[model samples]
Target: MSDSTTLVYKKKKKKFKIFPLVNAIFFIIVACLIMIPIYRVIISSIDANTSYNFVWLPSKFTWGGYTAVLTRSSLYTPFLISVVTTIIGTFVGLLVVTLGGYVLIQWEMPGRNFFAYMLLFTMIFDGGMIPKYLVIKQLGLMNTLWAVILPMSINVYNLVLMRNFFEGIPESLFEAAQIDGCSPMGIFFKIVLPLSKAALASIGLMFAVSFWNDYTNFKLYITKNKLFNFQIQLRNMVIDSDIPVDDAVNQETIGNAATIIAILPFMIIYPFCQKYFVQGVNVGAVKE
Candidate 1:
């Protein structure tokens, strides 16, 4: 290469490097800000003192808190409830959203746009707490796990994202499937779904996170202690000052452990889905 050309290429490479470095620094700062608070929560839970004093590390660490809370027969029950709810909610919710999105994009059903609009409207505006509660009560779903799962089965944003993805698929593929004697169901199960795996996995993770973190629905509808989700249980421990710490060995430590444990599942799952998550968000956010 000529000297001028080589110099220009070097300058461009340096400029590109600068931008990535700037982005890396920003990312690190944001990550540290987020991690610090979480670390403090973990620390506080393990700390012996109840005071809100700042500490970089726990003065003393003990697993007594974890054992005390976890050993209770009732404690494990809520964990079970949370796991079941998360799994069911994620699966059912993703299935419905994916199917619905596919139908909206591929099928020439009547009032499709209107229905899409309605779904989008719900995302924008809700019936508020009282009316939603009444609806749940009237349906006789209150105090059941169904209350948590049923209401949020289809997230409109995810539906729209999937719909967009489906729209992007070549119509020739569907036509070929039809010619091959494939029913709509067969096409969906065999072709469309397999092709849509990335989007599905992405939305599934989103649904899983939402269900895992939900506490309001459980708090309002679940009267049974055994039915409490992890978030609800965590909230009870954190908010209820009157709950006797002495009753549970090393209550502070246990609380910290629970806080860390509560978030650990999502932390583990996030990295796996992160690439798909970014792609999903970009594709889903694309306006039709």
Candidate 2:
């Protein structure tokens, strides 16, 4: 074959690959699977007709379910408690992870390898529920908001992600800060922390969502309903048959409405941080 013809044939063969199409098809199917359940919940939430409709769309729509959930005073307290605990937990978790990440990347820090190995060890094998409970009880944190906040304070995976991002920062910057008479603490607070916002934001979002959705902690450590967070409260409403029926909608409709309410905040907030989240995840994902 002529060289020009061979090049064109080769280019054509390279351009027409099945991988992209296969990937696209796979994602589309997965997307449909995810969306269908969400769609059903939404439809069911708004449907107040009190009749079973297996159709794609609801025959009638009403806001009774939403009103039923929103007007309840019991739901309001847990919502506020969740907001407080999530904010506190996310801030504390992020702070600890960021500092730990910084320390992990420091070559001269003594026992760094040992600590890193210990961190990894916890991720692989944790003290079981009974042990954790005993520790909490010993700390006198049981039945308090701190019980939930402190146990999940630092996720090892997030710490590792932050460490990876810190490793990617230029060593020259740290050296320059030291030359300017800046202590390691000052460098971390001013230079390192400021530069690590992308990783911090990404991990912060993860921590916030985790703290927001934590029901097991509340169920296990917190017996007092007044101290419960929104998810735990919602769990009780759903499973305990304790939801008030005096509202316009039935129990099932209210549960669907509660589900949407619970998930709506994350859905609304995710798009705003999505770019930073993706950037952080990708930036730390590789190493030289």
Which predicted model would earn the best TM-score?
A: 2
Clashing pairs in 1: 45-252, 45-256, 65-254
RMSD of each: 3.2, 2.4
Q: Indicate the TM-score of model 1.
A: 0.85
Q: Candidate 1: deviation at residue 163, Å?
A: 1.1
Compute each candidate's TM-score over C-alphas: 0.85, 0.92
lDDT of 2 by residue, 1-288 (tens): 999999999887865779999999999999999998888888888877544555577666778888877887898999999999999999999888888898899888799999999999999998999999999999999899999998888688988989899888888898899999999899999898888878888999999999999989999999987898999888887778676764457777888899999999999999999988888876566554
Against the hidden true structure, what lDDT does model 1 obtain?
0.79
- The segments of candidate 1 whose C-alpha lies over 4 angstroms from its true place after superposition are 1-18, 49-51, 241-251, 284-288
lDDT of the candidates, in the order given: 0.79, 0.87
